[model samples]
Target: MANFKLTISDKKGKSQSKELKDKEANVLVGMHVGNEVDATIVGLAGKLKITGGSDKSGIPMRGDVYGSARKKVLLSKGIGLKNAEKGQRRRRLIRGSTISEEIYQINCAYDGELKIEEAPKEEEKKA
Candidate 1:
């Protein structure tokens, strides 16, 4: 039973977030970065491409890395490192590219039209 928080982005730079659990969350397991998934799985109508994700501990996944294990890779300027001087490199802990049950958040890029309908606001009657 895995739970996941999905952050979906469209070509227009718009993004939406959704939470999935149990069976819905299980659909994302074993997927890797750059892989494509159906948006319908998350109640959307489009195709979603897997970009990246982070584990329960907030360790980000790197595309260069393989499998679903955490590793300490030497990074100069990347997702893990925020502010680094020129020619500066440091070993940072990052997760692999694969998605697993331990993953907490998954980032995706959506392809196709996305239209989200909002609930209508009610008007109060004047006394």
Candidate 2:
């Protein structure tokens, strides 16, 4: 069983922290630090991009494409490969191992606007 800690902050300096169990943590399997994800906190939904985090082994974790080995080659190619193919290649290069026992400390920022709507009040009955 793995646990992940998430620290989420909004543009207005408001922040929230929470923890996720194994099942919930799996949703972030492919996502790395600095990656943006849609999240809901206390009924307020928005987008959040991870800022910093660490693995179970205490190793700092970062986004897949942040400091990749193949980044240079991929970016150097002068549009040789199709967009889809390029994307596939990039995924393969940055994907993490499945067997790693890493619990990430994700710091994310809310990117989307949180909108709350109030129901209109009904008029009082006339005498």
Candidate 3:
């Protein structure tokens, strides 16, 4: 079971906080950095974009960098004797992790009416 405190603000600049538990909090599982979810604030709807958050394991979640060509180019330019593995390690360090209950803090940006929906379901195909 996971517990989380969500602080959201609507377009009107009014802010409110809510505590989510269990199934409600599970909606955030598997969401990577920058992913957006519909949330409700004070009976109003809004969007919650995951700007940054951490896991119960204390590992910080970061947006994927593999999609960035500039970062790849810069990573390839390291010039130290032990630099061979630095880029590899750095890549592993910046990627976000699968969500877990340990996530205590989640920061998000709220916007206009966001319709909360059930988290996407995973389906497996029989081979």
Which candidate number would show the highest lDDT if scored against the true structure? 1
The best candidate in terms of TM-score:
1
Give all candidates' CA lDDT scores: 0.89, 0.53, 0.55
Worst 10 residues of 2 by lDDT: 91-100
Question: Against the hidden reference, what TM-scores do the models get?
Answer: 0.86, 0.50, 0.50
Clashes of each: 0, 1, 3
Clashes of 1: 0
Q: Mind sharing the TM-score for model 2?
A: 0.50
Inter-residue clash pairs, candidate 2:
56-103
Taking the tens digit of each residue's C-alpha lDDT, what string does model 1 give over 1-127? 9999999888888788899999988888998999998899888887999999899889999998899999999999978888999999999999999999989999999997556666455653332
List residue ranges in candidate 1 displaced over 4 A: 117-127
lDDT of candidate model 3 versus the reference: 0.55
Over 4 Å off, model 2? 41-43, 64-101, 112-127
Q: Model 3 misses residue 32 by how many Å?
A: 1.2
What stretches of model 3 exceed 4 Å from their correct place? 9-15, 41-43, 56-59, 65-98, 113-127
State the lDDT of candidate 3 residue by residue for 1-127, as single tens digits.
8787765655566655577888888888666667778765335565687766554453444454432112222233222113555446333232233445666766666767444455455653332
Instruction: Give the TM-score ranking, best first.
Output: 1, 3, 2
